[model samples]
Structures are given as C-alpha cells and as structure tokens.
Target: MTDLKRVDIYDTTLRDGAQSEDVQFSVEDKLRICRKLDALGVDYIEGGWPGANPKDDAFFARARKELNLSHSRLSAFGSTRRAAARVEEDVVVRGLLSAEVGVITIFGKSWDLHVTQALGISLAQNLELIHDTIRYLKKRVDRVFYDAEHFFDGFAANPDYARQTLEAARDAGADALILCDTNGGSLPSQVGAAVAGLRDLNAVLGIHTHNDSELAVANALAAVEAGCAHVQGTLNGLGERCGNANLISVLPNLILKMGRETSVGEERLPKLSALSRFVNELANRPTQKNQPFVGSSAFAHKGGIHVSAVLKDSRTYEHIRPEQVGNKQRVLVSDQSGRSNLLYKFSELGIELDPKDPRIQTLLEEVKSLELHGYQFDGAEGSLELRARRALGQVPTYFERRGFRVIDERRIREDEDDDRFMGAEGTVKILIGGVMEHIVAEGAGPVDALHNALTLVLSRHYPSLGEIELADYKVRILMGSGSMSGGADAIVRVLIEWNDGERRWGTVGVSDHIIAASYDAMVEALEYKLFLDKVRPV
Candidate 1:
C-alpha cells in the first residue's frame, strides 16, 4: 500500500495575493475572507504584512479580536531585517512580533541577482539576514517559515551559494524552507528536480509558485510529487503578478489524485467555485470562465456527441466529477445540439416533454431555426424554459403590451446666449399580450430608452420582481461573409441577474440584435423568478 502522508496548506490570499493587479481589498473585506477561509478548514492563514501598510496592520489588529479561526493558525508575514540592523531592532520584525500571532513567516533574498541588484548587498550579508532573522523569530514563536524568494533561479545560477542559504535557515531552526517561484517562470520538470535535490535536507520542504507562465498549479504539484510536504498559495490564485498558486485547484488534486489527506474538510471541496466567485465579486473583478475545476464552464457540454456520451458515462468527457469540486454539469443548447440533448435538458429541468409528442418536435425545430438566426439558448436556461412552457400552452398570465414608444433626447446649453442644441430623438414601438401600455420615456441613448420603457410596463404586473441587473454582456461579430452582405452578422449574449430575499441567480439570453438580446435575457430573468415562486410557493 502506498503510504499517503498529510500535507499542510498555508493560505496567503490576504498578503502576497492582495498584490494582484487592481486587487485591493479593504480591511473589512480581508476579515470576511479570512473568516470564510478559516471555516473552509485551511491549516494556516497569512494575514498580511502588518508593518508595511496600515490596511494590513489594521486587519491583523482587528482580526485577532473578532475572527475566531478554529482550524487555522493566523500567520503574520514580512521580510527579514535590513543587512545592518539586528532582527529584534528592525521595524518589520518588531511589527510581526507585536501582532501576537503564534506563527511568523519571513522572506529573504536567495537569488544572487536580487542580492546584487535589488538589495545592493554581498551574498554573505544576505545569508546573515536570513539566518539571524530566523534565529531571532524562533526565540519568540514556535513556528517560523523561511520563504526563499527566487530559490530555483538562484540555485540554477549558483548552486553552492543557494544550498548554503537553505543550510543557514535550517541551522537557525526555521521550521520549513519554502522555494518561491517569485518570477513565476519555472517549469514543472525544473521544480521536480530542485525539490528532489532538497529531499535529504533536515527541514520540512514547501513550495510557493506564481502563475506568470500559467503553470503555478502544475509547478506546485510537481514539487509535491518530488517530496515537498507543504504547499503555500492563495485562494482563487490571487497574488502579485499573474497570481500565486491556486489552493482551490491544488487541494482536491492532492486529496483525490495523489491520495494525500489535508486538514481541510472534504465537504468544503464543493464550495470552491462559489467561494471563488464570491471573492471575485467582492474584489470587483471578472471571474475566468475556463478557470480549472471551479469555473462555470469547467464541465459544460455543447456538442451533440459529447453530450450523448456524457449522458451514458460522465467519465467519457469529464476529467473529474463536477460535484467533487462543488460544480455541476451544464448541457448547452446550440446549433450543434441533437434531439437527445434537448430531451436530456428538459428532463433535468423537470419538464415532462415526451420525445414522441408533436409539440416537442415543434419546439425543437423552432429552437434550431432561432439558433440559425443568432439565438443561443445554451446560457439562457430561464429563456429556454419559458419557450418550452409557451410551446406547451402553460405560460402564466402576463399583461399584454398594446404599443410602446421610447424617445431619447439630449440638449446642451452653451454660453447661455446661444440657443440650446438638441440631439435627435430615438423611438421604438412594441406590442405585448394584446394590451396597449403606451410608454414614452426619454434617455441619453436609444438602448436606455427602450430598456426603460419595457421595465415600466413589466413592473406593473410583477410588482415583486426586483430590478434586473446585467452581470455580463458579450458581443461577437462574424465577418467571414462576402462583401455583398450589408453588415457582419452579430451575436450578443447577456447574463441577467435577479435578487430574491435570500440570494441571487443569473440567467442568460442570446440574439442577433443587441437590443433584442438584452430584452430577451431580461424577460427570462423575471420569468425564472416567477417560476421559482410557483415551484417553491414563496
């Protein structure tokens, strides 16, 4: 039997991770995320550099009192003292010591290039900075980890000197020696070889990688297989450049693929994607659709053959089950979809549509025809359900729009003496449910006016339906057609969101015309809420 050892996962999402470009989290945000990470069962949480910035300092000071982290030991991170100062006298060291945390992590220059260029110090002085700092911190805390910044490149350049630095930290009683890919350009093969070389060292070995080369997770795993017992990373891969290793991706791979156990609870694996999106939303950054196990499209299927095969056995198309990492399989509807795909989707939604039913065939043909005209229902579940209900003659009683018009005008007054100039008024008309709910609203643009007019009419009947917010909107123009075609065919997809009392869910719509696409998605968003109300009877 292969002896599976347990590994420690240290999360630095609040420190090195917050350095990600444009990722600035307030102290309150940091505390909230830390609490979530603690509940998720990470072994260690590196709060921040308390001495470097007020925000980080405030987080550590406040988090210690308010947040009760049960499974995680809150760690304070910083650099070793300057070459000339003693460890106890340095401001950085003093700040860490004052934080009253049980664990402290300090980084020092291991690469000769950083010593020569960045620090302007001799290699011996740099070694002293690492050794003396660790020795001093050991006196104050039970655990002290030394992050060897740029260790791999340093080893490649000066094997003897780099090994000497690790020896110094080990001798000084540093608990762990973490090899950092500070530049994020190291390959997996190189990482494996380097960790293998350090296997015989007395100290515990760890890895800290970045994603500049898009290989942070791969490199960290390679280090683990090569014998490193600990992994350091940030939640959702947040970090300085590119990002730090994604603990979200790394944890499951360790547990499921490598047979290694972690302090993290098994149930928390499924919440990874939701937690990732929650952090991204709080940070005001767009989540990547293709991000490894936890992204929305990670297990989504669209092609006919793939979907059919997946229905037979998900392993045919999926590397790992979606539920293993808190995600679900999505069967997308597109021009490439087959009858089996539609039937499967309908069944999953609990809509009993028999394959032999004439109405089912009609709906299938209508969907395919609409797809050819640039309507994509794959991302629009609510819209597809609404279409299915309408085809089956089961739509709810909705008010009819007899006619509607939108007029957008903008006027600018220059110098008070000259007459104001007026922008052209844009207008649109539509009829809904045989009712004449005529609305003439003005806006800065035509699209705005049209959206306002529709909302004005729909709000009357669905008074409880909250505001429809656009989460994501994408536009793609296909230009391969011949010059004779007046304009390139356009495809617009929009994700609309609605908030109930408890939570919010998004629905999508796609169309050839931009306005129609937005409108279709908006209607679907409202319809989904309506359907949920009936099903759950809220």
Candidate 2:
C-alpha cells in the first residue's frame, strides 16, 4: 500500500455549529470546546466571527487569556472588505486583526449570482474584494485562508469567473483556497470535478460543505480523493439548516477508509466518541444514535444470526472494530433474539449457562412472551440480568414486599386566579427477617412518594441503599388509549435509570396503570442495586 497522504482537520463546531437552531453557546462554552478540539489534534479551530455578536466578541477576548491550545491554531472567520470599502478601513477586517490570532479566514463571493443580486457589486469589483481583503490581511497575519463561498455553484454557472475568484485570492497570498458548497446541493461528482479543475492553480485547496442534501461528507471525501488536503466540518454535524459535514464521520472515512493521514491521527482517534458526546452535551442536544462511527447503534447487533457470526468473528458483520472510534459492540435482546443473543447477554452479565441447558430455551421463551406483553430488554439491561439470574436461582430475596398505598389529592381554590394545590403521599410495608417495617412519606408526585416511602423502610435494613439515586425516568405508552384498549385501559411502560455514584443501570416495568408501572420499575431498580452489591437479608 502507498504511504497515507496527509490531510488537515479544521473544526467549526464553535462557530458553524452554534448557528444550529436551539444551540446557543456562551463564551465559556466556546472556550471549553476550543480546548477539547485542540486536545483532539485538530489543525484549525474557527473561533466564530468576531464583531458579529457580543458572544463571539467575548469569546475571543477571553480565549486570548484562558485558551492555551497546544496543537490547533485558532482562526477568526469573517467576510472580505465590503464591496467598495478599503481593506485598511473595513471594520470586519479590523475585527479579524484584533482577534490577535496568527491565522485568519475570510469568505468572499464566488457565485456571480450572489455578487450581482446579494452584494449588488460588479463581477470585477467582487474579485477585487477577494484579492484586497486577503492581501491586506496577509501582510498582517502569519497565515490567511480565503473561503471561496459558493465556489462549486459559481463554477457551474460561469467557470471562468469562478476561476478568477480563486486566482484573486491565490495571487493575494491566501495560504489555502477553500471551496465552499454554500447551498450544499452540489453532488460528489460535481465537487470532485470542480476541485480537479482547480488543480492548475498554484494554491493549496480545501473543502467546506454543508449537509442540506445529506451529501456533505460524500462531497468532502470526493474532493479529498481529487487532491484537496484540508477538510472543514462541525462535530456531530451541528449547524444551520440541515447542518455541516460531520467531522466525526469525515475523519475516520478519510483515514481508515481512504488511507489518508490527519492531524487527528489514529492514536487520538479513540477520543472521537467522547468528543462527540461532549459537544452534544454542551449544545443541549441529544446524541444521534444512528450517527456513523460514533453513535450508540453504530456497531450494535440485533439479529441472532448477525450476533452469532459476530461472536465468532466481528468482521462477519461489523465494517470496523467499534473500538477504533471509541465505541463498543452491543448485542441487543428482544423477540428476534436467538440462543446466541441470550448467550452473549448472559456472558455480559457474568452468567454462564450451557448451550444444552433446557433452562436456556425456557428463558428464551419467557423473554419473548414478556416482550409480546411490552417488555423491551434492549434498553433495560438491568431488568434483563435480574430475570436471567432468577431463572438460574442465583439471586436471593433480600426483603418481602407486603404492600404499598399511594394517595394523590388536589384542592381547588375558591378564587379562580388562586393556584390549586396538588400533593401525593405513600405508605410502604415490608417484612425483613420476621420484622415488619412500615413507612410513610410525602412527595411532589406518586412515584417520588413511593420511592421516598420504600427507601425509608429499606435504609434501616440496608444502608447501601442510601448511595443509590435516581438519574432519569421515562414513560412510554405501549398500547395507547386510541388503540383497541380505549381511554381507560392504556398499557404504559416505565423505565427508571439509577446511579450509585460508581455505576448506572436501567430497569423497566409495564402495566395498565402508570403509577403501578413506575412502582414496579422502581422496585426493580432497588433490587438490581442490592444484587449488584451482593447484599443479603438483614
């Protein structure tokens, strides 16, 4: 195999990603992301367009003092000097300089349609804008990159004019001329052909694309194959409209698939999933489970045949070792599961069962029957483990639950404007070692009350229960009121996530009553914790 070619990774998650709807990063958020990107070996971190907003302005001001990036060079994104404005006098250019960064990237009109209709500037004058902005900044900054905005579209509309735009930047000393698929409608072939056409230019080339057509990564890879060395994208593809090309997917494809080297080499590649999740956490966005390379389900196996083959050899089903990108292969248990799935899950729980054990088939039938009644073990592994262990008589009953009572009350105020009061209380009775413990507690809701009441009774019996805390709770109506069941008889499934500071697990319960379902899941959560710690009856 030939030596891998080198490609630079430019991350715009702080800037372009922040433009995503519902994503608003504070100055601190940007600073934290900058440090993470640098740690991940990104070559360039675009620190938003200074002077565009107070947030961006504050970010640069603070980054100068707090952000001490070791590997990545910070670049300020801005546009060229206004249509006829002097490069020395343009506020945007001055903003770029004030950022106190060694590298600067400024965009310019490449599409004649944009020059005429958007900027209302002459074609020749637009070229002058690209040239003058880069030329003036080049003399001041250590490196200046020119983003030829809408380059591909412009090239198709008027090939000569588009070439001139890039020529203007190249002659003006722009270190890298990046082709921007601003509309994100360009196909991979068009992007590859356009970048190929620019091969004659004596300038380094890069590719920046959006995900409007869901082809941003494809177009970027095509351009790389055609000789572009710089790739620009946002983490998790966070950006306006559809989003930008996802660097999470782009980096692995470039290195593992295309055999190209990147600033984020294989050594730092394992941090990709952590970095992806970190950005999503700060962005207040849920992680995309289906995102390639770094998603939860990216390497998950569900089919029995697939899991069976994967157990013998991962390559039978997986395209790449999930560990390459910091992900793990998961075997899901469901109605579609075979003995292979059960064996894998059992082994994961540290349980051993012979393949010929008749109990294995019985357990499989039980799981399928429960799933038919709305028990999904895929996301509730704690519950699945408990059930499997019970079949083997490995789990011991620590306490006997006698009963529980939940009371919810609402008092309407005489004055319509006055707020009504809603309260819930719960009573739990348990028998431990021939002693009965009854406890009552009040909470904001029925589930909370039941949890408080149950834990109050168990704390005296098992002090370890004090360490466990509820992390998350979700409810799903498996059979809705609109189904054949009617409004009064909807079956609901409740999932409760618990954490004892060291580990986390989820338990699930299904019932026609929401409160009953919550109680069932809550009890299982406590039982799983007891089982995990190997606690015995007091």
What TM-score, computed on C-alpha atoms, does each candidate reach?
0.64, 0.65
| Candidate achieving the largest lDDT | 2
Report the lDDT tens digits of candidate 1 across residue range 1-538: 1122878899999888898888887776677678678868888899998888888888888877777778889999989899878777998899999888989999988889999999999999988999999999999998999999999999899978888889889999998899999999999999999999987776788899999999999999999998888899998899997899999899989888888878885767765765786677556566688888988688889898998999789999999988777677878874233465577657746799768888987898998777655455543456777888888977765543333334434466555654454433323343445555565555445545655566665566555554554433434343222343466665555544445644345555555555566556655666666666663211
List where candidate 2 sits over 4 angstroms from the true fold: 1-4, 334-538
Where does candidate 1 clash, by residue pair? 270-326, 400-432, 400-433, 401-432, 402-435, 402-436
Worst 10 residues of 2 by lDDT: 333-342
Q: For candidate 2, write residues 1-538 as lDDT tens digits.
A: 1122788888988888899998887665677678779988999999999988888888899889777789999999999999767889999999989899999999999999999999998999998999999989999989998888999999999999999999999999998899999889999999998888888786789999999999999999999998798889999999989999999999889888988988888877777876786676566566788889888788888888998998889999989987788776778773232576567658756898999899999999899778777776644668999999889988898888888899998755456655577769999888988898888998878988999898888978888998888766667776664554556578787877677877667788988888888888888888889999999867
Model 2 — TM-score against the truth?
Answer: 0.65
RMSD of each: 8.4, 8.7
